[model samples]
Target: MAENKRDYYEVLGISKNADDAAIKKAYRVLAKKYHPDANPGDKNAEKMFKEASEAYAVLSDPEKRRQYDQFGHAAFEGGAGGSGGFGGFDFSSFEGADIFGDIFGDLFGGGRRHSGPSNGPIQGANVRTSVRLTFEEAIFGCEKEISINYKEECSTCHGSGAKPGTTPETCTKCNGKGKVMYTQQSFFGTVQNVQTCSACGGSGKVIKDKCSACRGSGYVIKKKTFKVKIPAGIDNGLSVRMAGGGEPGVNGGPRGDLLVSAVVSDHPIFKRQDINIFSTVPVSFTKAALGGKINIKTVDGEVEYEVKPGTQTDTKIRLKGKGVPSLRSSSLRGDHYVTLVVQVPTMMTPAQKEALRAYDEAMNAFTKNDEKTRKKGFFSK
Candidate 1:
């Protein structure tokens, strides 16, 4: 059967005996010519670009190139073709690999290996704590100091994990790269494996004399106190983030954030809903019927509100801008809803009972007279 794929050397316009530099130069020129960016929507140019990439992907690596030279495409055709192959190739996975560095570096900018500590700084873990606030304290912001146990850089070694006078040395195993690379032969091709260096445990450094205080870990549990400001209008279960206030970072990275979850205590007299304050005010039956002024307690102070005559129980009255202030804007506030509840005396003295009875008799007589006037309506008028 005729071979289904062209030789990798032919794809890059290079001789079979070409050196690594020659192969790279040829691939770069071809890649620039057939790059999707340069070709726009030309399908043939895209196909040529992919074919060249596949050829360079195999030939640029010494092991893959050796295997390809010995067995051609058959080296990656069957079970012998290990996990390494263009079948599952992702250009992103080749980001830091030296095989595609030169060509892709020109096509998509610089390419650098992502293995080991060179991958970049890692952020520290976040710490969470709950703050309990009284309802009044939540309505008006307050500051409270909280104690937390978190990881802090060791003062003895200044986070170097070495003795006070001594210092850490670069790892001999990985040469301070924090990772060791090794090649493994598989059915598909040669696969490069990058793993954390066993000697320095991926820190890229080894301490000869460990710090007595931190035991070379570079961090210690510390009790820290921080004052957190509880903002107004904050509700239960809401979180307040304190930037760079949590655990100390690793490898000189930035500290993580401290998350304070609010736990607002319930108030006996007032209930809150999204910046609004609700409360029930009790008024005597006579006050509700005859109309009178009653004192209402608010976050600001006690205020007088006029009860409408003949007001029914559960009547709601709004006190505008008397509620909790907005967290975003302190000047903005919500309304306070006061529900009026009329209280009737369960026990009455004889004089009080007689007065109520006389009032009831007068109301009955007035109702009867009004009914008679309505009955005689049209003709009488």
Candidate 2:
């Protein structure tokens, strides 16, 4: 298998020294090109898509990439490097699903995590979407309503897929097991493959008089609105999961979850680092020399801050408990840091220049007197 497979870097059209971002970019481009949705019924394109996905599944991970670089494909070959082949590449892992979801959604409508017994109840598929929040809203927390289009159980047949007056019968091909077992010749002698019943599509039942509303699919595309509560201090790119807020499950299984990813807009005045808030305030040269109370904008509102006398440019002041509240613990809050920047006069009127000259002369005289005093001291002598 290793001898026949192409190199991961060669598949993605990248170098061995390619960074994570580069690999992701190359994968995205290739995935979009060879995606089944983009090239429907093209077997070659489908194979390429799976190949690229497999390559990305390994190279995108740091540990797997390290092993691959050290031992090549032999690292993943069974018993070749004393490691189980492809066992660590779990498709259900958050990293793997997140990377695959964006591309696979277009091909499969949405990604599905298959689990449970073959003939038993199965959990519904999860739904994914994104939400953009204002910086203030993310800091203070707010409720938002988002609309999503998803599949729901048909009302006419109540998810049975049978006609109103009729019911479904157990699939004869698999004897209601929903799967068929078969054996194939392999190097180890024989391998068993369990496949879904083609007659019933793994539903374990076949409907002769199908429901007109759902066309025997038991589900219909429906639009729904859900109110989402965004936690305070929820940062950008973080996802919020809503349990049992997805599609209806099969055979009485629990519904899936809804994952809403947040995109927090940047604030013009304030920048956030973890829970801390940072902002720069401009102060005049006179204010730096003779400091007084100044108005500063905070998340809550404008607040007055006192600058120490003789405060210099680039001076930083901290306001305790003025930053964002912690998402985990609302009682705990971070401090706000304000950096003061003293503005120098770029242009001056004639009167202002004359006043500055007089002030300079006064400062020169005071400095000279101080020097003479210091020189007269015994230590200086």
Candidate 3:
């Protein structure tokens, strides 16, 4: 038996100098891959699993590993190919062997299922949704209705999942504990595996006559309406949270929150930053050259602004407290910046074009006369 046995380190695919963590890490990979739960009814995988488990049982223990490294498999046997003594070594007697729980936890979803009821309160997940808002609605705040696909207990059966005249029966397979236990023999010892009751789908009670309204799920999906008060100054993609407006909670826990993301529509004449509003107002070339009142569109309304004389194109002007209202305080407001874009006429009547040409000639003649007058004044001085 000893002569036919392979080296412990080779079985686990580790080195002679491999640390405890490395040994456990290598064993975890093999165990997860070749475990009976993963590869069911596969004899080759089971054989590999047994080999790996035996290798881990020997190598994980410091004293056993030291003995194996010095004397090899013969250390566990009475003699070469002997059947007595270390040949029948029970690895379940290995010291501090709590790693099985951790390995099993990883194989399962974290916690090990025990042969008992585990129906407990767990918080529901949050629900996300989006709401479309106009640019001004987001700036000045507005109330909007949001539709939610919500779940609630059926009114006909009141979450029992049974008909109105019937009640649920206790699960016979798991004895109402919602779990079933079975034993699996491994190198260490008998590993008792617990699973959810297949008959009742882990629910302690089973409905004989199902509720027609809920189809035996104890809950029904319905369209729920919620009035969401969108805050002023809420920007696009920002969310508004409504408590208890999401999906129905399980096991009587509180319902999740409804997160509504604001999708603000773009305005035709305006753009916004954090708190400031920006807009480009087209001013006629004549109005820019000669100062005059122009109507500027703002979020509040159309306001009259005086264009400064000789105002260049793309000149920026500020309107105090004309931007978005503060979300925290309605009394506070941001400034609106207006860019005056001078608009030149692309086409002109023949008479208008001739008048422009005459004005240009007159200006050039006036410039020459002014220069001559300046030279004469200097000479006389």
Which residue window of length 10 is worst by lDDT in model 2?
184-193
Candidate 2: tens digits of C-alpha lDDT, residues 84-116 = 554445554324444444555556676332334
- Candidates, ranked, TM-score: 1, 2, 3
Per-residue lDDT over 285-373 for candidate 3, one digit per residue giving the tens place of the 0 to 100 score:
88998899999889888999888899999999999999998887889999999998999899999998998899899989999999999
Local accuracy of candidate 1 as per-residue lDDT tens digits, 1-381: 118788888899889999988987888788778877778899899889778878887787777788888878877765456444565554444421454334445667754335335525768889999999999989988998888997888888889989999989999999988888766543223545566678987778899999999999888998889999988888889988999988777677899999999999999999999999999999999999999899999988999988889999999999999999998897899999999999999999999999999999999999999898888895587
Candidate 2 — which residues are off by over 4 angstroms? 1-116, 379-381
TM-score of 1: 0.68
Candidate lDDT scores, in order, read 0.82, 0.83, 0.82
Residue 9 shift from truth in candidate 1, angstroms: 19
Q: After superposition, how far is residue 17 of candidate 1 from its true place, in Å?
A: 28
Task: Give the backbone clash total of model 3.
Answer: 1
TM-score of each: 0.68, 0.67, 0.66
Cα deviation of 109 in candidate 2 (Å)? 22
Q: What range of 10 consecutive residues in model 3 has the weakest lDDT sum?
A: 78-87
Backbone clash count for every predicted candidate, in the order shown: 6, 0, 1
Best by TM-score: 1
